[model samples]
Target: MTLDTDPGVAPQEEKLEMAADLTAAKEVAATDIPPELVAQSFGGYLRAWMARIRSGDSGVLPVLLGLIGITIVFEIISPNNVFLNTGNLVNLFQQSAVFMVLGMAEIFVLLLGEIDLSVGYVGAVGGAIAIQLVQPVTINLPWWLAIAFALVVCALIGAGMGFLITRLRLPSFVVTLAGYLIFNGVLLIILLLGPFSGYPTLCTSSCSGAQNNSHIIYQLMWGTIDPTVSWIGLAVIVALFGGSMWWRDSKRRRSGLVAPPPSLTFLKIALIAVIGVVLLLICNANRGRGVVQVVGVPWVIPIVLALLVVWMVLLERTRFGRYVYAVGGNPEAARRAGVNVNRVRTLAFALCSATAGIAGLLYAANQGGLSNNVNGGQLVLYAVAAAVIGGTSLFGGRGRALHGVLGGLVIGAIYNGLYLLGLAAQYQFIATGIVLLVAVTVDALSRRGAATGARA
Candidate 1:
């Protein structure tokens, strides 16, 4: 919604948008056009979508299909049919909270055609700081401050690495690699020097008045919303979000601007409502094993969803997002086009690290503690893998926040399904590597298709 273009360009874009809408109204067979532009009637929209797919603009289709296929296979094969059990499924997603957030973190830099090898440990460091700060012996900062302080430090670390890459004219890979090594050492030292030595855990079950801060941190992952409250929240969210979306599209269409057909917009809203209902059903079901009656939507679900929306808006609807895309697509061109390429890159990295800090916090919450045993190297690998698998191109300038969630679900499914089958960590890694390879291949093909279209 934020325009970073000249006044003259605004009128031209408006005219083009109106023309695109008119073409859609005619239901014309358009070639080499943006798929969104040919979305007047449902039939034309479908055809345009098909054409786009044929041109290798697969979006998340492949991954979504893969996820479905994985779910089915695991449901049939896992021992005791527990793979698809509602309780187990909810727990699997809870475990995937870390992977999902980290994948999203990587997308920020990946969109710029850069890499951050240090985010895994950097996030771990943030979590460690959060834990250390609430200790009875240390600074003992408040919970909110602890979380804020950790994210801020992580952002600073990312900014420093990005600064090195932009100002020193260094390779992003090398700079981030060095950062990874440095942070790994730093993480070890923080864990070792702490009062808890190797294990610093959040206290929840037996927490007293003095330990309320620790309890709050622990509840982030372990707690759940009441079923009634969850349903009410879901209704409010759907109505507000859906209403806003419909209003925006209606306004645009009324003005003859580019917008999805009315039918298509309504269908999208209905789909969102249906998805929300399904997820709530899964979470609201009885997940407890005995008389405990543990049934409600996991707190992590809304937390991750909120973060996803924040990232999506930042990357899709803001001037900074455009600058990132422009720089990633071509830094020289972006610089020539009046963007401060270095500043954009640095800010992107800062945001990426801060996001990773959120993942770290969630990780700590899920595990009940911050420990030195975390496989940060593997974590970073999975983060990047999830982003790529979700259709983010390593070549950059083409990705979405939603892709990370989808990709993380796929990875989480693989992990959960394999573990249920008694497979080892090595097997999980092998499976993930294979999937990542396929995703990279698809990305290359997609890039080729887009290039071919441009040439045509």
Candidate 2:
């Protein structure tokens, strides 16, 4: 019998055709799947987030929960429940700003699996330069110019340190340690030998230490924007935040990629709005003494927020950011991928110092002036604690600007609450040490779990 006419041959050809058709049908079905349906509801979002947490991607959940716990505990322990008072909250924000900025500075280097010990004194030097330039007895440059000069000098200093690390293969820890001492001495010399030394009136005694009370620098922290302007600015911020999030999700969905649920997006926006409104209301309240009324949000809050936004964008939405993660996660792989590991590290260090400079200015503003006695060493330690506590891994490749803010708030709350309860500095130190240890422990455990899961 001819093959074409054979019954077995015909059956085999039919089976082959059927299998091809089935595969084609499956391809069509997959293409037709709607991406939005993947996470379109609140339940779906929650489930997805739970999965992520299980995978050791907890993000800010721990920090947020810890903050809540701290707040409640403090409120319960305080005699008058002053921990949650509006005025006290305002002060908490002011206190947190310095730490937040410093924590952010540390994040830049920490993200590269490196550390910058010099940020504290680097910042002091920046502030000293700015104050010296703008002081009446000194060069008396424009306030803005003074600030510009300060930032430039700090940036250059950072860049130079970066060059040495990248070109000579020096350890960042050692370089910055040397910087810590050098800048500390430099700060003292600036205060004692220059115009600051001659101006007896400028150097005033304060509780913390000796300070140079520069009117311009002091106002930067204490000054307030108009209430109307603050409201308008806040509205704009909320709108932008919501709109950006919505746009991102929409784009992902349109591209047939999984996006966060709409419900989750709205929840996030609502939470942000509530927080902003509450902050505005508290700041708008007259928290002044018996005769004077201090109203409106302090200028420093917006400045900090702006910097946070800028850094977030730089980290999340830029080529440099991707490179940073790559280098942090695996420097060898990054090198093979054509990433200039040295340049990235160098720039990271520079950025870290520049951020420290900004923090120094805020510190000076808060203290009423730059002081020779400013403890950069202690501040650097706090910055590291803040970043680590906020969820940034010491091993690098995982962190955000938001971590700094959240962590700084936690540290600030502890300090503020203790002061309110009349607790000694020793208690604050012990409490902070415990918190840092817990955070580090959690980080190590989570990383280990992630590694195990991957291996499996």
Index of the highest-lDDT prediction: 1
lDDT of 1 at 204: 62
- How do the residues 1-456 of candidate 1 rate in per-residue lDDT, one tens digit apiece? 111111111122355567768767787575455644435786766666666666667787888878889999999999988988889889888988888999999999999999989889999999988887877566667899999999999999999999999999899899989988999898888777667867888886988877778778888898899999999998999899989989998998798776777887888888888989988999999999888888999899999999999999999899999998998899899999999999999999999999999999999888888887877899999899999998898888988888888888889999999999999999998999999999999999878876765455
Question: What is the C-alpha local distance difference test score of each model?
Answer: 0.85, 0.80
Model 1 has a clash total of: 0
Alpha carbon lDDT of residue 100, candidate 2?
92
Q: Candidate 1's error at 137, in angstroms?
A: 4.3
Tell me which residue pairs clash in candidate 1: none
Error of 1 at 341 (Å): 0.3
- Lowest lDDT 10-residue stretch of candidate 1: 1-10
- Tell me the TM-score of each prediction against the true structure: 0.91, 0.88
Residue-level error in angstroms, candidate 1, position 89: 1.3
TM-score of 2: 0.88
